[model samples]
Target: GIQVEQSPPDLILQEGANSTLRCNFSDSVNNLQWFHQNPWGQLINLFYIPSGTKQNGRLSATTVATERYSLLYISSSQTTDSGVYFCAVTPMDSNYQLIWGAGTKLIIKP
Candidate 1:
């Protein structure tokens, strides 16, 4: 079983600021996804990168399986970005079970 951990358990930022969130795993992973839980509790998939870097608009993510860690970056943050960011991973030995981190709570102020 793999253990997932997200850093900076909580974060607060003003609009237009940039922030970085991190996730660390205790073992190798074959599938990794980043998700956002909005204020209404709807979960949105942000990234599905198991390795390497990928970007979408003002958001980007990088995962290094060898190092057992991943990072999510948010640039020019907005109030809409206020939510809980989660890191979910499927270990190399597992097929469908996803281990999820406690999540990083982000609050963006106007």
Candidate 2:
């Protein structure tokens, strides 16, 4: 089983600001994903980086399997970015179910 934990349980930012979110795991994992849960409750997959760095517009993520942690970076924040960010993982063993973090709530105020 893999345990997931996210730092800065909550965040508040102004437009154009930058922020970083972190995720730590208790065990080695074969699959990892980052998602943004919108106010409407839709989950948008931001990254599927099992062990690498990826960028998409104002968002980027990096995962280090050796250290058992991952990071999600949000640059030039905006009101549209307000939502809950979640880190989920599936262990190397196929028998385990996906483990999800408590989620980090982000708010970008005007």
Q: All models: lDDT?
A: 0.97, 0.95
Tens digit of lDDT per residue, candidate 2, span 1-109? 5679999999999999999999999999998999999999999999999998999999999999999999999999999999999999998877567889999999999
Error of 2 at 76 (Å): 0.2
- How many residue pairs collide in each prediction? 0, 0
- The C-alpha stretches of model 2 lying farther than 4 A from their native spots are none
Model 1 lDDT on a 0 to 1 scale: 0.97
Q: Over the stretch 1-110, how does candidate 1's per-residue lDDT look in tens digits? A: 68899999999999999999999999988999999999999999999999999999999999998999999999999999999999999988888799999999999999
TM per candidate: 0.98, 0.96
CA lDDT, candidate 1, residue 83: 100
* Deviation in Å, model 2, residue 59 alpha carbon: 0.5
Q: Could you tell me the lDDT of residue 105 within candidate 2?
A: 99
